[model samples]
Target: MTRFPSQTPHGEISEVFSDVFFVTGSVDMMPGFRISRSMTILRDGDILTLISPVRLSEAGLKGLDVLGRVENIVKLGSYHLGAHNGLDNPFYVDRYGAKLWALAGMEHKGGLSTDHILKAGGDMPTRDLSLFVYESSKMPEAMFVLNREDGVVIAADSLQNWSEVDEFFSEAAANAMTKGGFIRPANIGPEWKRHCAPAPAEFEKVSKLPFRHLLPSHGTPLLNTAKTDLVQTFSHQFS
Candidate 1:
């Protein structure tokens, strides 16, 4: 049997909105360097979907069970599997027989593979959600727009709102990230911009989405004001 990454220190999953939950966790970047990351969970009746999943503790698994069965695992970022300790998708798939979803061009590193290919206009895990793809990015990067409570945007690397350094970040990692200009509120992911170089028009289309909340893979949830709060970021990056 292939051994997958073990569960690391992560906070308990907590409800951020109606049926949306998030868990803050740490990613091992290198030997002793670690940084914060997050996973978004969505519930529709008894079916649960995990987006940009983080390996959880035994207790966390039990908590997840109480909510519903893990039926779907969604990957919204092309580079998500590259995080050293963030490779937990197969664990869920093997354990619960869950289906994995990702964009067509996303790299399946470390023997990771997807069960479904998500597109800009195609089937989604749920009916109330719609997909948006970054057509200009070198790698496949996408976002989910949930059509509920006005609107909610779920993203991986395209958007972020770190707010502040949290427990998941080691001291050295935190300092380095701050210097790298990643510890900001309502900002485009610095590294994603440098690597992906998505077209400005792509974000312009995102800005027009009806989303009011943002559940990012690497930052705190920006509720209600997700769209308004990112006004300057969109302008600065695009303009």
Candidate 2:
């Protein structure tokens, strides 16, 4: 078993909406820069469901304990399931990669694997949560909709909203991301488009979803006017 790197301390948890919380962490993506990573926590009744969870320290867990018991852990897409810390609950993922897990090597490091495979338009066990799979991308990705206040769309790498490069980025990484169109607010991630090659029609369908808040794994959350912003962003990229 490959020993994973120790969990680094992510910043304080901030509320994104009434029942949604977000935490920012750092990931070594670009050679010299530590890219920003966002994780979403949703409160349902007395249970707390984590979406694309980053490794939280003991203090972080205690902070989360105040919200509710961490009952369900979900990986929205193939790329964001690396922080599973041996929780016995079933881990969820879309059924796009059966033969080969996209990031199995990383999964091994975290001792986590997907046990529950969600399908497009399928119902997740969690109440008021629905999953939609994106078929056009070369890599299988899914976007989840939470029917909380004003509705929220929890996405993975498929959708990003980097208003500006955060301080975590090195100058080189910031410049490259800015030139590649990944630093703009309410825009598609450049790396996602270049690597996933998502189809325009798929985005067109996503644009129709009834969501007002966009909580993504890679960037800032758009609290209001999320639908309009996403439609315009998709139109600019696909139209």
lDDT of each: 0.85, 0.68
Candidate 1, 76: how far from true, in Å? 0.7
TM-score of each: 0.95, 0.82
lDDT of 2 by residue, 1-239 (tens): 11444455478889877778999766665357566777888888877777776766669768887987665666666544223322212222111111112221223223445555667555464678777777767766788888776778988788888898886677887887788787888877676677778788888888777789999887888888888998988877776
Clashes of each: 0, 0
Off by over 4 Å in 2: 80-111
Q: Candidate 1: what lDDT?
A: 0.85
The prediction achieving the highest lDDT against the true structure is 1
Residue 15 Cα positional deviation in candidate 1, in Å, after optimal superposition: 0.9
